[model samples]
Target: MRLFIEVPVWLGDTIMASVAVENVMTHFKGAEVVVFGSKVATEVYKAHPSVSSVEVDESKQSKNRWQWLYQKTKTLGEFDLAVSFRRQWSTRFLLWCVNARQKARYRRLDKASIHQVKRYNDFAAHVLGVALPLGDLVLPFAPHSFARPTLGLNPGATYGSAKRWYPEEFAKVAIALSSTHDIVIFGGPSEQDIALEIETLLHEAHVTNVQNLAGKTTIAQLCAYIGGLAWFITNDSGPLHVSAAYKVNTVAIFGPTMNTETHGWHNPNERIVKLDLPCQPCMKRVCPLGHHACMRGVKAKDVLDKIALLA
Candidate 1:
């Protein structure tokens, strides 16, 4: 059988969506699973053993998205089943193009799902009449290693500064964690400036193991090294989700995003650090409140305490 799965835009969401892929394979062992994804997503799961092949959608999926996708999926050949995690009207258009005998998609957007690792599997149950027991969307695959920081700090939040815990707070966490572990820092090319700022502070504190890997390492290599960590402390970013999927003991700091439903799929051990600010979880990419109390209120000691509990 040939199967098709339309992917989510973010890395964390893709990790969780792997659960649905697992479900499809569980019921149809011999089936060939083909994934249609945003370009970056194809790279994120490049090594996935179960995927027969991945077709990258070069066109950006956005409003008026169906006009492009309708012409795109026409090339996917005939598929036996098409299952989608997307709820947009655009999803219907892609389903229309796939030459599949059966098409399954969520009837409504379900927000209560914590990890989206399992809830994403609902498409099958709704469309195929298969009531597979519910499960979390955490991937079991190990990331490829680059350099494991005997001590690691990811001080940048890819989404925006609002999601970042104070860099000084990260430095303090590093000063403390450095007492027991070697430290290396990770961030994106855009965030090298922040990584430098934090590294300089730690350097002044005479803290060693603080090396800047921001923009230096690739995502795959970073994820590989993170999987081997004794513990990972991060803001609400893709790495946090990757580490969670890797099942590393984690303490996640949050500001604009809520910690309840989006932190870690099914890992009960994961902790999200935030204060009870009334305006929290506003869901904006940037903070509307100039002060950002929800994130600023989180202290390094509070976060370290959570890591201590894990140890």
Candidate 2:
């Protein structure tokens, strides 16, 4: 069978959707899957064993987006089944334009609370007309081996400052763990400055076994490097989910976002570190109230304590 899957646009959502995609792949054994999404999101499936190809969407950049999308969908020919994990009108339009014998698109559930992974899985099960157990977040990159244990610090939260913990706190965690484990800082292009600040703090403390890898890695390289970590300390960001996909022992710092809804799905090794603040779950791009106490209240010691337990 040939399957066309439209993954979510964000890096984290794309990873979470892997659970559903894996289930669909298992149900239709030996199905050749083709994924379409943003460049960053599509990268998650580039190394997937079940995926035949990944097409990065460029319609957003085109002068005539609908025309571009129509042309793009036309060139793909036909698929046995097409599924979209997104609820946007554009995705619905794509589902209509694509030539598939069967098609499915996500519909929001009325449940009070549901993890993103479970929601995606429920959608897949609904499409398949049967229930199945949830699957792991799938990334097929081989883990890199290090001579000494390595600790990864991800201080970048693309959502906003509301979701980010302090870089100083992250550096403190790195300094404490640096005695036994090599420290590697991870971030995207927009987060390079924050990663650099953490690196600077570590250097000021005379920590030499540290690598600042912000803005230096492709999504694939990030997966390979993160797959090898003995431990990962991160904000609720894309890399946090990436670490979960690899089953890396992780300390996920949460602030403005709701952990219950977006925390690592079915990863026993992952631990969430968050303060139960009234202002939490605000889900704002920036903190509504001037003080970002939701994030500020969480100390490096809190994260380190969780890592200690995981260790």
Candidate 3:
């Protein structure tokens, strides 16, 4: 049997959806899975045992995007089943266009506080007519080994600046941890500036054992490197989820987003540091009010304390 799966666009969401993907693959045992999604999001399944191929969905770049997607999806031969983790209208159209014996797409449950991992698992369970147990975030990569003990710092939150903690605070944590571990700063192209700021702060503090890897790593490299970390200090972002997949001890600093819904899935080593302000979880790209007290109230000490307890 063959399966067609369209994952979510965001890297973090794709990681969270891995549990459902795994469940479906297991149920259809030995099915050759073909994944479709953004280039970055598709990387999560590249190393999966059941996935035969991955297609990057570049529909947005086409002149007639929907038509392009329909044409693109039609080229692939018939599949036994197709599943989509996205709820967009285009996804509905894509499922309709594809030549598949059966089709399933994720539908939001009435429960307000369902974690994303469970929601995806529930979607897969509903489609397969069984109760599926949630699994750990799956990123099948070779374990990375570093010469010295390494601590990772990720200060970028792709959702928006409102979710990001201060770079100076990240730098402070790096400096404190530097005495015992080498610092590895992680970020994507858009986060290079934030990574550089942290690097500068670390250097100014006379910490030399640091590598600024912002914008230099592919998604695979990011996974491998994060998988090797002794500890991770990051805002709620893609890398944090990556760390969780590898079971890396992680300290996730939450700002505008709700931790209850999006926190790392099935990772006992993960610790969340956030302020319980009444105005928290505004869920805005930018802070609505001028003051970002939701993030500002969270101090570097708060993160360090969490790490201390986790250690």
Candidate 4:
């Protein structure tokens, strides 16, 4: 059998949606699985050994993107089944264009899921006519040669500034942890400035073992780096989910997002640091009110306490 899976576009959602993709591969071990997604999305599946092939959709232009995808992915051949974990019209249009005999999609825009991992797993279960248990967000174990017991700091949240913890606070945490653990700061190309600020702060504090990998590593490299960390401290972002998926001891700082829905899925060792402000979990890219108390109220000491407890 041949299977084509449309992955989620967002980085964290793709990581959470990997649970269903893994199920599809497991139930049909002999079937070929082709995943269609963006660069980050495709990279998630590419890192997994279970996926047969990955088709990347690099068209960033909004005007003719769907048409471009339709033309580009029309040659995916025939598939026995196809499932789209995403609900957007473009993905649905691409699903229609794919030459798959069986097609399924999750369409719950009116309703919000308690958690997205459950949403993905439930979608796969509905399609397969069996209850697929939500399991670990599994990725290939990558070995890194960094001999020191390392602590990873992810200072950027792609969602926006509302979800980000203070960079200086992250630097403070690094300075505290750097006494015993070598610190590695991680970030995307867009987040290089934030990472640099943290690096500068660490250097000013006389913590010399810190390395800023922002803009230098790809998503695959970031995953490998997270896999080898003794601990990962991050905002509620993609790397948080990646570290949690890898079962790394993770401390996730949440502010404007729903912690219940987006916290590290199925990872018991994960600790979420957040302030219980009334305006919290606003679900906005930028905080609506002038005060970002939800994030601002969470102290560096609070995160350090969580890390100490993990020890």
Q: Which candidate achieves the best TM-score against the true structure?
A: 3
- Across residues 183-250, which tens digit of lDDT does each residue of candidate 4 receive? 99999999999999999999999999988999898777888899889989999899888887878899
Give the residue spans of candidate 3 off by over 4 A. Answer: none
Sum up the clashes in candidate 3: 0
How high is the lDDT of residue 82 in model 4? 86
Task: Please count the clashing residue pairs in each candidate, in the order shown.
Answer: 5, 0, 0, 0
C-alpha lDDT score of every prediction, in listed order: 0.75, 0.90, 0.91, 0.86
- Which residue pairs come into collision in candidate 2? none
Error of 4 at 180 (Å): 0.7
For model 1, the run of ten residues with the poorest summed lDDT: 140-149
Which residue segments of model 4 deviate by more than 4 Å? 61-63, 109-113, 141-145
Clashing residue pairs in candidate 1, if any? 117-137, 144-224, 151-182, 151-183, 183-209
Best by lDDT: 3
The model with the greater lDDT, 2 or 3, is 3
64 in model 2: Cα distance from truth in Å?
A: 1.6
User: Could you report the Cα RMSD, in angstroms, for every candidate shown?
Assistant: 3.0, 1.2, 1.0, 1.7
Cα error, residue 185 of model 2, in Å, equals 0.4
lDDT of 3 by residue, 170-201 (tens): 99888998999999999999999999999999
Model 2 / residue 248 / CA error / Å: 1.4
Candidate 3 weakest lDDT stretch, 10 residues? 105-114
